[model samples]
Target chain A: MLIPFIFISACGADNANESEWRTLDLNNTVLLTLPQGKVVIELAPQFSPKHVEQFSSLVQKSFYDGTKFYRVIDGFVAQGGPKDGSEQDKSVPLLAMEGQFSTDGKAPFTLVQRDDLFAKKTGFKEGFAVATNNSKSGWLTHCPGVLAMARSNEADSASSHFYFVIGQAPRYLDKIMTIFGRVVYGMNHIQAIQRTTVIDGEYAVDSREHTPIISMKLMADVPKKDRIIIEVENTESASFAERLVKRRARASEFFYKKPPPVLDVCQVPIRSRLVKLQD
Target chain B: MLIPFIFISACGADNANESEWRTLDLNNTVLLTLPQGKVVIELAPQFSPKHVEQFSSLVQKSFYDGTKFYRVIDGFVAQGGPKDGSEQDKSVPLLAMEGQFSTDGKAPFTLVQRDDLFAKKTGFKEGFAVATNNSKSGWLTHCPGVLAMARSNEADSASSHFYFVIGQAPRYLDKIMTIFGRVVYGMNHIQAIQRTTVIDGEYAVDSREHTPIISMKLMADVPKKDRIIIEVENTESASFAERLVKRRARASEFFYKKPPPVLDVCQVPIRSRLVKLQD
Candidate 1:
């Protein structure tokens, strides 16, 4: 069962050092080729060791080059890592869910929130789903664009199947799964697809249907000129904090409604600029 | 402008009452047919009057039959109400943004989460974009799955163009545009669509080169058995309170770190179940 986590802090365009903005490293990026467009995700090796290890190794081996984001729950998540591939891919045994989140140490851009007071828990933000609790330290945070391994009913069931948080923070799925990285760009590409009715036959279908994923690739594999340049607003920048606070406080003339005093970490509007890198 | 309002409520399902279950009126349900599958959207007249008038009238006239959910934002929204239509239907005169949320003494749900505490907005639950400040009044609520009118940057620019919330709640767009209705069923269908990207240009280029929606339609206009069946869990249920509290608890094995103790209405999950009506 997925548990919804409170957004830690959402401050967009609020803070910025003089030179905080930077472009993505395409050499280390993976291109999620969807039917509509290609989604470029820059993995984070700085967060977790084991989690990133599995992700990098798999991506290098072309593990998710063709998997589809099969399950998409609005205000929640869009999952893609697929084990439903070739006989060999499926033949590879799934890995146990990595427990990386720990609550002991302090990290950057990290804030902690819990529904109940007694329930002591905290972690860093990978994006939205990859979180780490110091109680037993690892890496993973549930922020938008954060990617994690998808699993079934068991905590140890996570594998190549991965997903993205496209909605509110579903922190409930936290300790139970392994979250690895986040999408620094191309989130809109995944956000704007059409949907399908319940696969459940007549609202109560039988067996699961085998969905097909055509192809996926890494930008590094493509020619440098072919790459689309993109840059994300630095998280620690004052501008990002300002943008978020203004958004949470109400900036548009259309919003006659006064919003709550705070913003959810998942609700933060992180901006990404199209970096036109010329030859 | 699009505003997302993701609400996260605790399940507290233990206190849920069977009596709270309410079936949707078949006559009022709109079945959306797409190549992917069938989507059922129940328009709520309780939210917006002016927008619903134009919407239902359009549905009856088959305005959206061949329309597609043009722009989809993966965890945010799937918008398809476009003023631009195919040669067959042609575009209809856009509807002006009617500030009707200022209604006095609106229908009351057992659960009370005051908008005055947050934003002064409300909308049609069946099929309308409404806004309201229960204390002051009511109109369009940016809850998830809501089908709203799409307009230009102008205040009253929304014509027949519309969109649906597929991901996080975009509350920033509230009150600026007119919300027509919401999708009550088969949200998964619209949520599963693959997102599109810019093909011709490298950066933000011509808007037309952007992905275009194929078409959209009401399911009632399609095959009989293909219609998707859905059941929305009562938000006012006892389980809701529990879910609300637990959701805030953030007690999990994975959270190596936790943010803080905070919760927002938009972060809440709107529970649902699939059911096929017996002939």
Candidate 2:
């Protein structure tokens, strides 16, 4: 009889002290309501200021309401925006890609692994999976639940359309796409979104079968009484570093044969919880 | 406008010659029928012979019919088997864990990357993602769609319960669990299966909410007229190696900034397609 062990202990019990947890900035958080459930996304202005600004602006104006996830590929990404471009504000200029940025060595980086397959160093920065080159340039990794701007062949083409990674970490897209946020809650809802069928080597483009986004609103704009509070483990906190160390060591008694003492940056869990507001 | 490009080119066009695609062995292939769709799995007898034999025997006896995916954790694994142990045959003795094998240096291997975070070397063998230590001991990597046996605290306790990797590659379980097969087709269906919500850091244990398995049958037991043909690219084939090289180089014009040449073995696509039988 399998005991149903918590496979990835990263998402396990909330053992960290309250001080180690940081409540999400309501202004930077987006409440994306889908037909299934609400997905809470935390925008990363430090890495992708223009993208975050544009996305927040679009959300405030209800541009994403009733938009369908036009392109949802299993094991890749779920892209959603105005399907017919009728709802999009064409006047808003397409922003140049904010894919990667030079990081000062002092930036709060809790290292997860060195010599990553996609980058020289991999870790968590401000609750987002991050990869860096020679401790200089850093970009958000395409881990599951990452929010990135989708673009065409041109590097600077991204504007309103964005995607959420719904499957494996597509490291190949790490530096190529502009990632601006991560899902703090309701990742299961993102995974539950209907996927587009691929026929004859191409994704089915039928918008009718796709999942629809009911509406997207900045948490700051939502009424406090109706808002769902989300708090994530501060990646820079000492307790978080201890969690990473414990994961790497795999010191649990459940393992009959302990695996190698190494962990993928994407596998590191940044824990989040929904808090009920007091009366 | 986002071009909606084939993000993971591994699942893209069937450009390989007919000879490069190997038809699955009917005896080793299992056809799992879900209400949503059908999933085709290829059993790796070369690795875990006893586990495969037990699974195939159970499948032929209709042991997996009506079994529920009791423990489905998003971004981890989908576990399934006799929930109440009513259909399971208790006469069969519990088998020792066959988690890894000693591979001779002559074993056909198509290397994807060396110095993998979890393993010394990572590659593909017999159309399955694999990792090996010093080219001696080899085990199947727990990439998405891999079929592995689940057990309790004791490593050798695995009997009939098994799991499918549903999300990111959980490399930590590479050598700790017995991996006997992989999903060759219909991974989308597997991903689409209903997920058990985790309330307060614990997966919901109510089996009623889990997705039920309609039936599981060995392809060999099915009538020829009803069997679906599945062909996977032979990892050892030259064309397959060429495809890997092209992927590593990522010389596509679509890449504005070419990512690192390194490729994760789990990311390497072993293409499979369903073929209609000629009337």
Candidate 3:
């Protein structure tokens, strides 16, 4: 229940030169500061287009300005986008549900082939989780801190009632939902909300789980000095690959047992580091 | 994100009868009552030998009689352990960590291998997690509600202070840690705990996050009829497999768009029913 320790080894490999890092454009960045910590999200317009568009519009309109994180799962993810205060206050009609799984589980001899819902999967690529087949049709994946649209039976239901994936990859919903962006920094902030209510029997959708975002805006709208520099763990870099391999196999002496063979994309972590960058 | 509504075309099937149902004896059940609702966990002894053995012994001794579900993560998991409330609480020196990841990312092939403190990947079989290769031998995995030993640098440092997997699978820690048992039920109770503390700049020897579990006890120790009755979603059943596959693909019209192309073992849900069987 607690990620009490974020064991950061003395990798000591970070470049002291700031120019090496990139500053996320405010236009694409969403700062989510909750009780546990602060989380910044970088929307992926390339993946869920309509959702991204909707999110961008919401940011501009300040729709999430005073909303609460509302939900958080330790070691999982903290989610925001719901209005704060009370659920009794009805603002807009529930958002219409849209966005469908874009990938085709064509790979033969796999878990999906054996299961119906898993016939397909979703994952992150270049920070944008997309569901792709050899056909190249994809959507955003639901990794930790990924911002997504909350919908119902009707399509186009994303009206900022969003959620973040918290615990174990709920891949059963893969290819069946829409993911918009990921938390580029401060996911811990989202991991500390209190419970509120239950939705069906699933994790009761609680409003008290997390503190509201207070306000949300595209980094472009914030002052330039407020911008924070961040670096994505180069999943392609040798260091990144080594970390991945190590994560997949555990480099710690603590491991006397091993896990199953293959690594699923959803289980992989696309980490981002926060730093102060100045040219 | 909302889970797609699963419209059971039940063929209006005769719901399920005795042959289709398996009742958990109060004597064998662990009763966890939460503020919102109660959850019942069906223990799997095949996976965690030491922890299970310890848990059973403690249950017999009424170890967790008044323990509170101290930690709760929305999507991740809530963990309840550590004999709380005693003026002077001493740590329970648990056995050494078990389960080894394969040396070549092979044996536990089902386990999504990663790079960390060890070497290898393994997968899930029979609902428990294990990893292995030519040179190592052991068992342990991270499944939602999995009771695991919370240890320091020394592999044997785990004490009564334990943890659980609440949200999306964090398989990165597999095999590197020791998994004791899983929450067959009462997840909501644990998931409802308020994470009042924010980890600041990290703490060691397992700091603030190691909240206390008020107390716990096996139902058998309670009054005869006062005991709780629970049922686990039979994983070995055809219905369970059907649910997993059917839920995964989102083949129904409901899934206008899906997220990923795969599913992990932790996301596999196990339903609980509160019905008693006459002795």
Candidate 4:
């Protein structure tokens, strides 16, 4: 009775060619330094240009320095930003909603599931999980590690406050929230962020328990000697396509009961690696 | 530009009658005490009889006391048990696989989604998320807080070690693994458990970083003064059905961009509350 717990083998990237990987752009990459570790985020400026621009400008200005993850709901999201009613906060303008955008059939979309519960189709595009309706319009799915803007009751009211999907994929918030980026590396640190303990159905608002954000800076702003180089598997590459096929097939001997030959967009592992440029 | 974040209002349990809730039976309840807090688990003996019996017997003998959650993978599972190859550990019998069970149409099921990616139908039964193949055979889904048995490559090798789904629902393992119970209360404590940091694609195997389990006990064996009363919303109740309808509708004013009129089985909330019997 040898009970050796086994995990499904992750797709190997060792055999992948250099063309299968794409180095993250310094202009769009953000280095979010928390108390635990550095969380690397890659912004999708092509999808939500305004939101990415706003977030990048804030990073450049050190607007997120000394902020706290104020509202963290377990199995839902971890939202954080400067909530102080300062003059700078008052000056930030509210941008119009960019929840979903119309897409041509030309985007490098790799299909994962044709029959998703929330949309007509679900897949990955530019390393982001996406859902589309009739291949005409698409929006990023609310998978774990997704970075989206938080808003009030009004639709077009997202400003500086942002949230990370830290648990199960809240697909209900798919087309409603504006998703602009995702954590390409150090998702473990995001999960390790201290959660706000809700006592008797009431959220603890005493910010003392919240995890602090030491600083957030764009990779371009960081000194050349201190940057961590990140490279992600290109979703459009042939090697990635092959890996997706292998995942859907589950051809390993470990699986005594083969699962359905359908892949959830969130389950698709977009592999990434971090290289420290200097000591 | 007031960025006030708003959350979807949870289904109200205040208006429901007492009949709509089901008080858990003490015989099948387990209280797993961790350093952070106590987690209340409701075992489903009807699904996996052998596994439940084995687990109950172990709880009575304090087999899980002082065990460390050695393999806590972020966004995956927290696997832990006494791996210290003692004579008692070698004496445990290997149990046959009870991954799924046949079902008649008589089971009290509340339909949540008709089109799930992995199953023909998905819904809730006896307060647990379930997926069925043509309403004939069903298995528990691997949603967050689900307690399941861990085994090796061989299907029927599970004995003493167990794991809990701590993050996104891994639907692929739904039918392959045997799910015996779910965390009905204090899931926050489960989410707050220390995670094993994987450095450079290698998992840290140090035992010191793992969270230690204080003890596990059956609620029935505990004295009346120490028991915590747990009541879960009945999935078969009319109020719960109505709540599911409201969740699918997104009729609240807060949702300016109403989501699709479909629900993911994992997104449905099965509310529970804890009542301390003594101070």
Best by DockQ: 4
State the lDDT of candidate 1 residue by residue for B159-257, as single tens digits. Answer: 677777665566555666556555665555566554433322244344444334333445555466855566665555555556656666666544434
Q: Where's the lowest-lDDT run of ten residues in candidate 2 chain A?
A: A9-18
Q: Each model's TM-score, in the order given?
A: 0.66, 0.88, 0.62, 0.88
User: True contacts preserved, each candidate?
Assistant: 0.20, 0.53, 0.28, 0.54
Across residues B1-279, which tens digit of lDDT does each residue of candidate 2 receive?
234454434335433322587889999999999887888899999999999999899899898898888788778889987754463535445778888887876653778888878877888888988888775678888999999988878878888889999877988887788899999877878986777756354334466767888989998898888786788888877788889999998887668889888888887767886674321
CA RMSD of all predictions: 10.7, 8.9, 11.3, 9.1
- Misplaced by over 4 Å in model 4 are A1-18, A84-88, A197-205, A224-226, A277-279, B1-18, B84-89, B197-205, B223-226, B277-279
Tens-digit per-residue lDDT, B191-210, candidate 3: 54545333222222233444
Better of 1 and 3 by lDDT: 1
Which pairs of residues clash in candidate 4, taking residues 3 or more apart in a chain or in different chains?
A: none
Rank candidates by DockQ, best first: 4, 2, 3, 1
For model 2 the local lDDT of residue A94 reads: 87
In candidate 4, chain A reaches a TM of 0.90
DockQ, all models? 0.17, 0.37, 0.19, 0.39
Q: How many residue pairs clash in each candidate?
A: 164, 0, 134, 0
Structural RMSD, model 3:
11.3
Give Cα distance to truth, residue B89, candidate 3, Å: 10
| Model 4 chain A: lowest-lDDT 10 consecutive positions | A1-10
